[model samples]
Target: MIRALAVVLFALLLAGCSPQVETDQARLCRMALPALMADGAAIDILAETPDPDGRGLAVAFSARPSGPVPERHLAACRFREPGRPRESRDLIGLTLDGEALGEARLFALVRYWLATPEGRAADPAPLGDLTRAPVLSRRAAYALQMALDGLPLAAIYALLAAAYSLIYGLIGRINFAFGELAAAGGYGAAMTALALAGLPPAPLLAAAFVMAAAVALGWGFATARCVFIPLRRARGQQTLVATVGLAIFLQELLRVAQGDRASWMTPVLNQPFALARSGDFVAAATPMTFVASGVALGVALALVVVFRWTRAGREWRAYADDPLGAELLGVSPSATTARAFALSGALAGLAGAIMTASYGAVGYALSATLTLKALAAAVVGGIGSLPGAFLGGLVIGAAEAGWSAVFPIDDRDLAVYALLIVFIALRPSGLLGSRDPVVEGLRQSRS
Candidate 1:
């Protein structure tokens, strides 16, 4: 494993040395083209015309038909001038290369040329009137492409799900501080990456993974030992209260330490790569940091496997089945709980770190809401079922993404939460999750 990791790190280093293209525009184009093409009245065309400078082609599109058109399509595009590739300006005036036309212009020209009276007579067809001017710019298509890739959305959901699932599986209690732990992991790894900027991408990834794992483990262990353990010993609702207190305390600490200043993970190792190409549209490259979710999932699985098969795992299962019997067998409940806390905490930390880097920012205030949602996901997955937690995370994540995609729900903070309530009402045990022990116990005792 070490050797393979080393090779990957080395390859990343070599890859990083190569130049990366600015991807924002390319990504946008990918999204715009397909959507534009889908419109009944929308035209799919590209045109290149001349520019005075002659270094690059001057691109422009025609305005779409005006007034109320039955078609719900509106074209949007942007163009960048020479020497300012990063800065996009409106594509005004004439087309460059004097040959290829911007999508809008090409569509317009096609309509005009094809619909000319004499030309129509040659083909024997009546031409429709042009209404709205094409509203698309070169920049618009590029922006569209970025949105369509859905990678950023994917990364966000993946992180949230992983964190919730890991915590729910090992701790058997929602950790309010899970988001903070994720923040810590991300900030910690990001800082480390910044410090080791000279390292290759693979090494940077490895380093971030290791740092995140360490931080998560430490945080989970400390929280469980110092807080949850005491509460569990006392037993009952006290545990829940203590967790809440700990969560608030940690959030405040993070706020004080970092302030409201946005914290971000270093993407020094990230390089842009094209995802797809269709005509003039292309998906931009994104930092590979988002891929860290895979690592998180793998670690989560390893933990589950270890819990299921290892000697320690067997002991844990035995304790869960019969605490007094396990104690008679010489297994220490305190020790096992401590171990579980450590494992859960570490997973949380790793998730936080992955998310921070993936999203590019972390704040103390962000914890409460995310944690609550994670809890919802956990419950939805089915408490005590590790696999269920993972599945639940995906469902929640996907639902959240799909909702955002289809509707403008930004103002509705409770929308996602409301969905959670619905899930609980509809499937109390969660899609694949099992019932809480208390409920199960009551049923068994009654039986």
Candidate 2:
């Protein structure tokens, strides 16, 4: 793993050393100038200057006299929308090319220059249709938007991770099928909403949440009772493999029953509340984001209180520390395990319902991605640690949002997995994981 990471880092360094690529303005100049210049005229692009707002660029070019052209000619070409490379070609103009410049080309050039910051500053008439309100800058807007969008998602991840951690902490076994429980929750809510269409918003939403939790709870209980309990005496690997197969089975079952189409929920909190604004750019969040995040946080906090204060919580912890001892003491291992699964499923279901509402859609494929991300959170924060899971979810969400600001949209997932790899390499035990007593003993002995 270390060697693989080293290789990846070395490849990234090599990529950084690659040659610089041409700018959009330069490429556009090369394509447009030749067609407008006199036959055999030597055209050279001198320099390209971006407008103040960075939305457009002015290209200066020199054309040597050739054929009918008798003297050196210099002219400037401007692009109104520098980011839109395709549209830029139709907006170029030539000066020294003289009579060779066609009416169509001249018209395009005029529009391009008029759209530039300099041109707009000179005469705002060209952009009369555009918004003149104060708004955030483009880059700032994008970054803020991503951060806001990631908050609720992070909360959902926290809930999912917490569920996984709870189950693992109690049972010392990974429930690979937990992701399917989440998906089932989401699908349950969606179906309920459909069946209860035309109901008041409050009742509809309440029904969705209740139905989702109930469905997920039932699934978790059955899995524990029918599958996990029977395998309790079996090897750990056997249980792990069983859960994986179960996960795949559940995913396929959902796919066949729901069809491949994504089910979309009606917009719950669709009203946008702008947080920052400059010119045309705006950073905003919806009510749903805050509400969902708040609910997830509340659930996590409630669980913390329960575990710290309640009798059942004490029993659960006792079982986690030593199941055999707890069972010997009359703490019904089966009952505790069942309760843990049910509680975990309830949390997972709630998370799924919130996520589906936030995204407005749910599908079978989403389960795998969510599972992987939640697992990454659990591992990075400290496997089997609730606080660590929440912290890790936030870290992953922030990293993903921040990386998206600088990298291509398609590479976002790559950035996420890279973060996971780095965390694994640097802190295999996770951020909050307790040190292994065996490893500590080994170190002490060596000393």
**lDDT (10s digit) by residue, model 2, range 169-281:** 77777888778888989999888877864443456667888898899899889888987778777753888899899899989998999988899876554445467665566
RMSD of 2: 17.1
Q: For model 2, what is the error of residue 308's alpha carbon versus the real structure, in angstroms, after optimal superposition?
A: 1.5
lDDT of 1 by residue, 1-447 (tens): 999999998876676544332232222222233322323333322332323342233212232344344223223333443211332222222232243346676454334443344322331101111122133455664554545334433334444555555444444455667767766666677777667644445666677768876876788788867886666545445666777888888878878987877776544424343444444444444455346546646765786789788988887677665666778999987788778767666666666665665665677777776677667767777756666666666666666655665567683346667877988789878777665675355323321
Clashes of 1: 55
TM-score of each: 0.64, 0.66
Predicted structure 2, TM vs. truth: 0.66
Q: Against the unseen true structure, what C-alpha lDDT does each candidate score?
A: 0.56, 0.72
Clashing pairs in 2: 134-278, 134-279, 135-277, 135-278, 135-279, 136-277, 136-278
